[model samples]
Target: MEENFKMVAKTLFGFEEILAKELLQLGAQKIEKGVRSVSFYGDKGFMYKANLGLRTAIKILKPIHAFSVHNENDLYNAIYKMPWENYLSPKGTLAIDATVHSPLFKHSLFIAQKTKDAIVDKFRNTTGQRPNVDLKFPDIKINIHIDRHQCTVSLDASGESLHKRGYKTATNIAPINEVLAAGMILLSGWDGQCDFMDPMCGSGTILIEAAMIACNIPPNLMRKEFAFERWQDWDVDLFEKIEASLLNKTRDFHYKITGYDKAPSAIAKARENIKYARLEDFVHVQHEDFFKTRKGGHQKLHMVFNPPYGERLNIDMQDFYKNIGDTLKQNYPGTDAWFITSNLDALKHVGLRPSRKIQLYNAKLEARLVKYVMYEGSKKQKYMK
Candidate 1:
């Protein structure tokens, strides 16, 4: 039997608690949350499941070694002394990524270089040959992290991040990141219960993400490969078993998921992306301005989207946002609308006060993921008040 091991799932800021909840729901054990990451214990099969099933995770890392470090030299010496033979051969290619949170080690790029040098130099000194570094298609990807003089090394189990879900072939001028899209959907508390929507759907990312969430589908089933597949201990049978088990857990979604984009190009791109995700039947895309339209029926609705932040797309920022508020208040009654935007200035224009606002990051820009509740009628308006 394969032994249980500790693994870390890296995520974006403000998603640690949600990611930890996801890990626990996925049957992970001894889960611990950290800044932009969550650590837990599970077997190799569990690792495969976490990689395949997690929605908010950016990457899953399996820590192979850890030690205390005083400086760069100590970091290099420790990496050099490890038995690298079991993980990668001298003939294989590798890539190193480093993150620094230590006073001693300030530069991440420098740490990556030192760690890579330690491994290759150790091999070259003994065998007159060294493994090559291939950033694009490396056989092994190593991650180095220094936290206040404590250094930890791990194998990057997720290749190219899980957000590259292999579905988006087209993008708009400012499309949201896939992981962020999934995270928003997960945070919205939607469970395929009723119909879903993204009124200003730019590329249909939220719609596709919603469909997958509804079906309990594995987010990375379409990914080309995981980094662990290149590891020496890559167990094909166990991986297949894990894949099959996750596939079996897929559920049927009875509700509809839909998207609307005002721009023709965005609608075309959304259609293309929905097709690529193989969710065309489960998701519908239409070209319609959100403010001009109202809810199709009196049914309850769930929405998640990223509207223009006025960063690159030059629409009337305040007016556009005000229209969003008006549309929801007038047209989209009995709906829970959620959108993430970096436009703090524009959010002020959205007349109605947000019911809930959560701080998050959309890349380097600090942003807010907010929710609003639109009532059904004047009778309900009193209740909302």
Candidate 2:
């Protein structure tokens, strides 16, 4: 029988609860939610499943050591004592990623460098051969996290952030992160019971994520590789079994998933990405201005999108947001409109009071995920005026 061990799944700022719920649904035990991470207990197979199946997680880490360190020397000595040969070979490659919140360590890079020195020095002193650093692709990736006076060293289980879902071969100027898109869709409570649309589907990330959620498809199934694949204890047979198990659980989606973009280039890129995800059968993309379009059918529609926030684009954001409200009220009744934007000023011009507002962040920009419920029939008329 496999033994259960502790693992942490790191996520964006506002996704801790959503990620905890996802972990519970995935059969994790002793689940505890932190600020931007969740800790749980699971075996090796469960770890593989978490990396492959978790939609809201950005990366998973397996902690190997923890200690108190107030200075660089203490940090170096603590790391040097670890048995590195168990995880990496003397001739292999390695990479170190560090995050520090201590007054002692102001620079994360220096801490990473100090960690690398300790590991390499230990190898060189023992076998006269040390591992080389490979930032892009490494055999063993180490993570150092220092909070105040305590430090924890972990092995990164997912490489290159799980947001690199291997589906988006093309992107627009400001493409939404895949994990954020999935988290938004899940937070909006869209269970795929109705039609889904991304009115301003820049690169079709929301649409692709929605389709994956609707069908119960694992988001990382198409990913090229995970850091665990390079570990010494990697079990190809066990990984294959986990993959087959996840694939077998994918259910059929019944409703339609659609996308729209004003730019022809965006439409083309979205189409390319959707095809690459093999979600063309469930998603449709078109080159149409969302403000000039209307709801196609009477089915209860669920909308989620990442609209431009005037950061890079030179346009009148106030007028653009007004148009969004006008189109939703006049054309798209019986819909639940939800979107994320960092432009709080432009959000007021939407001209509709949101039923729910959740604070979030978009790449360091303070943002909000607002939901405006447009009721059907006469109730919709009240909000229209």
Candidate 3:
């Protein structure tokens, strides 16, 4: 039996609680929440499960060593003393990613370079050969973090961001991150109970994530690889068992999941991506302007989307947002409309007050996930007072 070890799942801002909840539901022990991160204790099999199942996590890191450092030499010496040979071979390739939150260490790039140097030098001095650095494809990906004077070294268990999901082959002008899309859907409290829609579905990310959530599907089942596949103790049979276990948990979804886009190109991309995900039976994409459309059925509906924030496009921010509000208020009733945008000024133009506003980050831009509830009754009494 494999003993449990601590692992950290790194997530975006405003998603720590959800990630922690996900870990807890996945049977992680000693769960702890941090800023944009959640830590927990899980065995090797569980680690494989996390990388394969966690939707909100950008990466999963397993901390291997920790020490305090005041200077560069201390950092180098501390990292050089580790048993790198056990984790990588002399001919293997390596990559280092660093994050610094300490006054002692300033540049993350320099920190990454220094850490890589220490490992390479250690191997060269001991075995007369060293691993080569391969940023694109590496056998071992290391993570270095500096908080104040404490340095913790970790192994990257997820090679690429879990958002890749191995399903999206096409995207529109501004496609939302898959992790952010899933996080927003999870936060909205929609659990396949009602009909789901993404009116401004750029590439259909929200729709796909909603279907996956609705079916209780593991998000990373289509992913090509994880970093642990290259680890020294990589267990193929164990990983297969974990994957099979997750697949068995997927339940059938009965509600409709649909997407709409004003552009035909966006619709094509969304359909392509949706077909690639093998969710064609559960999701439908149409090329139609949202402003001209009305709710089709009287059943309770849930809408989550990433509308343009007037960032890269040249659309009128005020009128665009006003139309969003007008369409929802007049056309769609009995719907919980939720959307994310970084344009604070434009959000005010929506006219309808948001029932809930959550501070989040869309890439580097500060954003808000706002919800507007449109009731089923008369238009005058639709909005919450």
Candidate 4:
């Protein structure tokens, strides 16, 4: 039987709870949430499953060692004492990614370089051979994190960011991150209950993520590679078994997932991405200005999107935001609209009081995910300030 080991899944800010819940559902034990990260105990196969199944996780890391380091020499000596031979050969390629939050260490790159030097020097002294660095494709990807006087070293189980879901072949200007898109849909609490729409869908990221969530599909199933696949103990059969298990758990989605864009080029790119993800059967995309269209059918609709935040697209911010509110108030009823924007000033022009406003971040910009509920009937709706 395989032994259980502790692993941590890092995510964006404000997604730790959702990521922890995802780990819990995946049968992980000892689940605990930290700032922007979740730690759990699982075996090798469970590691594969977590990497494949988690939607909001940025990367899953297996902690090998932790120590108190007061200076660079302590950090180097601690790293040199590790059994790197168990994970990679002296001839294999390697990569180091470091993050520092301590006043003692200001440059993460220098820390990474010091780590690389320590590992290579140890190997060369012992075996007269050293591993080379390959940032893009490495046999072993190492993560170094220093917080105050404590340092933790881990092996990155997911090579690239999990956000690279391998579905988007093309992108429009300022496309939303896949991890962010999935997190947004989950935050909206859309469980494929009714129709879903991304009225300003760009490259169809939100729509693809929504379909996957609604159908219980694993997000990383289509990813090109994971860092674990190159490890010394890589298990193809175990990975396939985990994949099959996840596939077996997938439930069919009954509601339609739709996307719209004013640009024909965006529509084309969205269709291409949706087709790539093999979600065309469940999703539909069209080129239509959302302001000029009205909601169809009587069933309740759930909408989530990342509309223009006035930074990339050249548009009048005040008028554009007003039109969004006007369209929802006049054309759409029985609908719940949710969107994220960095422009808090423009958000005021929406004119409807947000029942829920959650603070989040879009890369570096502070953003808000606001929700506005449009009533079902012709009864007078309270448009709060």
Which candidate tops lDDT? Answer: 2
Pull out the clashing pairs in model 4: none
lDDT of each: 0.91, 0.95, 0.94, 0.94
Cα lDDT of model 3 overall? 0.94
TM-score of each: 0.97, 0.98, 0.97, 0.98
Residue lDDT tens for model 4, 1-385 = 9999999999988898889989999999999999999999999999999999999999999999999999999999999999999998999999999999999999999999999999999999999999999999999999999999999999999999999999999999989999999998899999898999999998999999999999999999999999999999999999999999999999988888989999999999999999999999999999999999999988999999999988888899999999999999998898999999999999999988899998888988999999998987654543431
- Clash count, one per candidate: 0, 0, 0, 0
- What are the per-residue Cα lDDT tens digits for candidate 2 across 148-216? 999999999998899999999899997999999999999999998999999999889999999999999
TM-score of 3: 0.97
- Candidate 4: Cα lDDT at 218: 97
lDDT of 1: 0.91
**Alpha-carbon runs more than 4 Å astray in model 3:** 378-385
lDDT of 2 at 296: 73
Ranking by lDDT: 2, 3, 4, 1
For model 1, residues 1-385, the per-residue Cα lDDT tens digits are 8889999999999999999999999999999999999999999999989999999999999999999999878998999999998898988999999989977876899999999999999999978889999998899999998889799999999979898888889998877888898888888899999999998888888898899999998999999999989988899999999999989998998888989988999999999999998998799988898888989788899988898887868789988999999999888888999999998999999998999999999999999999998777864565778
Report clash pairs, candidate 3: none
Model 2 scores a TM of 0.98
| Location of the lowest summed lDDT over 10 successive residues in candidate 1 | 375-384
